[model samples]
Target: MIVLKAEVFNDGRHTGENIAAKLETMLSSWGIPKENVLCIVRDGGTKMKKGISLLIIKNIDCLSHQIQEKFENEEDPLLWWKVNSNKYGILSPVAKEYLVTPPTSVLSERVFSGAKIFYIPHRNRLHGERASKLLFLKFNIPSLQFNY
Candidate 1:
């Protein structure tokens, strides 16, 4: 899994159009061309669905939201997609893109802890893109394996 980038989103209005615009801007900034994006994996909120038309991308319902009660199957999605990507043609890359995204299971307290670690009261310049990368690395590195 990869975090790619983790920039702050301090938009005043959280409308679907605004969200889509920010997403496009972020994607462009990250050097990800629009053609590479198959669809966006987001919750089934009305606003999220609304962004589909504006974002010019299909919306893939987040699996966490899809299987809310419990995950009975123990299959890894990345492995499954990797093995079957060729079978679906264009969909293969699309599914793989979504599967590589790091999952969000952090609790509220841990998030506050990350905030504390990144931004102390006196040294409050740690925000925007720099802080985003640090926080992403801190949370995701533990899940990665080393082969040394």
Candidate 2:
């Protein structure tokens, strides 16, 4: 999962237009075509729904959220779709994609927490480039392997 942005919102209200503009800006900055954006998974907030509707892309509800609402344990909705994929035929692939979406922004929040740690009092004087390099290595180095 690529994190496009991680900044605090200073706006008084989060309107649909504002959300759409932000999304557009992010997509444009990354040179990602809007057509490549499959679906948006967001909480069922009025503004979020409105913003998604403005994007002209499909919107899916978070699977973990549905499980939380109706089940005591974490249920794998993708497993259910896998079992029923043969029954659904062509639509199965699409269902599987939607099922894998994260139900919340907890992962991103964790990254922000890590950033806060790196930006502590004494180290706060670190330049933006240095801070960014530190964060990049902090988050990404573990994923690399030296097989030699």
Runs off by more than 4 Å, candidate 2? 67-91, 94-148
Off by over 4 Å in 1: 7-11, 67-148
Q: Between which residue pairs do clashes occur in model 2?
A: none
Candidate 2 lands at a TM-score of: 0.45
* Model 2 Cα lDDT, one tens digit per residue, 1-148: 5787754447866898877777777778889887777544646677866776797656655544443433325767677667766654446798787667578999778778778978888886889888778888878777886433
The alpha-carbon lDDT assigned to residue 25 of candidate 1 equals: 79
Highest-scoring model, lDDT = 2
Q: Candidate 1: minimum summed lDDT over ten consecutive residues — where?
A: 63-72
**Among all windows of ten consecutive residues in candidate 2, which has the lowest summed lDDT?**
63-72
lDDT of 1 at 29: 88
lDDT of 1 by residue, 34-121 (tens): 6667554565676756665687775565655543432237988767767665554456677777667456655656867896787888
lDDT of each: 0.68, 0.70
Give the best candidate by TM-score: 2
